[model samples]
Target: MSNHEDDVVSALKRGADGYLLKDMEPEDLLKALHQAAAGQMVLSETLTPILAASLRENRPSADRDIQQLTPRERDILKLIAQGLPNKLIARRLTITESTVKVHVKHLLKKMKLKSRVEAAVWVLQGKNG
Candidate 1:
């Protein structure tokens, strides 16, 4: 039912496995449900291009802008890309959560990214290099 584009993007960023507009016909909705149950991502027709554009825009070029990151920052970025929460990342790195937050903030700024989800996509898609 949500028509807000930002809401749709945010939901996906937060790990929503499927997204469908409320206006979708019943048959399409059922098909989407089945697709979701089968471990496929489902998106409304209108949303597909939006998601694609977001991913394309967020993807980095081959210059390895990650070179701007320190070794530790790179490590934190990798964990963030893996979808680790700040607390868990801190525990894994033996650093304080606050410190992890600081690193995340710095890395996000350094990479010119708006959120951890973008960073995750970049890393997972091998765009960080």
Candidate 2:
């Protein structure tokens, strides 16, 4: 799997043979997919921190102002980290575009981020922190 987002991870856990990110250059993504189809583990440097950070403590920080998101929201957060468009997230989540917007708004508020890019960065950083 090669995507740097949760949807890809979910897909992988659900049995995807390959998972290239939308951000990857077409040539590289094609190469990675080819490698995956060849039975090789195709990965990228962007994935290193995520793999490393999956080991974080699970306890919630009561002192923080960040809202505790629902499991569904967390899933959305993962998609955001992948830099997916709201329409794409809606398609993946099987929700309406308006609903995805609401989730994005909620995520921005909960994470105290001013932009989706910031939230994406935070999600990546949180994984490795």
Candidate 3:
């Protein structure tokens, strides 16, 4: 709704459900609210193009790829992409939590990504191959 790149990016990164403008009709706002309550993501129609462009701009350059990850680091990256926290990843992988953290740190560095969120997005974008 604000159509500001920084605000849109920040809200999405922080897990905002929807970013509707205040200028929308009351009925539309109510519909968005109900859609959110029903567990759907509600982004304003106007935001899609900008949001897509922002995502593209933040990604690692073409030469920097996920292929640099070690085999174990790749496993951890996949788990991170699945939204599993370190503790759960450790449990699922039969490793220590600290070990998982170490792998995560390594994987993030190798992928040239900043956070688990970025890694997850990268994976979802089919960049993990």
Candidate 4:
């Protein structure tokens, strides 16, 4: 629904609590709804294999994505995880703030994340290798 490359991927990015197909079994749909209402992340059982295959074929895993970062980008990512602003990161890295901004943009794109917070959280969650 939001601006995204794909609907399923977009939904996941937007923090959808659950993903269910229209053709789901009535009982399973109800159960998924209940689980989501209880603050659980739910995915349709049938969708698991298909989603996994699609992700494996289409998108890099988090570690793979992190491995794709340039050294400068990785440094910036660590700075971001430390909650440093671009100016501070630039000063610490002895790069222009604009250059820091550019690196941030590239890193976000490489990680397929939307914003600095997401990038920070991703790194904090130990995917920043």
CA RMSD (A), model 4: 10.3
Per-residue lDDT over 25-105 for candidate 3, one digit per residue giving the tens place of the 0 to 100 score: 899889978866754456676776666577688764585576787888888888776656677788888999899889887
Model 4 lDDT per residue over 4-35, tens place: 23665556657554467777789988987786
- Candidate 2: Cα lDDT at 108: 63
Residue-level lDDT of model 2, residues 1-129, one tens digit each, is: 345456544554454433456688889988877765644445555764553343233223232233477667788888877756677788899999899889878866775555554455456666313
The TM-score obtained by model 3 is 0.62
Runs in model 2 lying further than 4 Å from the true structure: 1-67, 127-129
TM-score of each: 0.61, 0.48, 0.62, 0.52
The per-model lDDT (C-alpha) reads 0.74, 0.60, 0.72, 0.68
lDDT of 3 at 110: 71
RMSD values for the candidates in order, in angstroms, are 7.1, 11.2, 6.1, 10.3
Better of 1 and 3 by TM-score: 3
lDDT score for candidate 4 against the true structure: 0.68
Among residues 3 or more apart in sequence or in different chains, the pairs in candidate 1 whose N, CA or C atoms overlap within 3 Å are none
Candidate order by decreasing TM-score: 3, 1, 4, 2
| Two-way lDDT contest, 2 vs 3, winner | 3
Preferred candidate (TM-score higher): 2 or 3: 3
Better of 1 and 2 by TM-score: 1
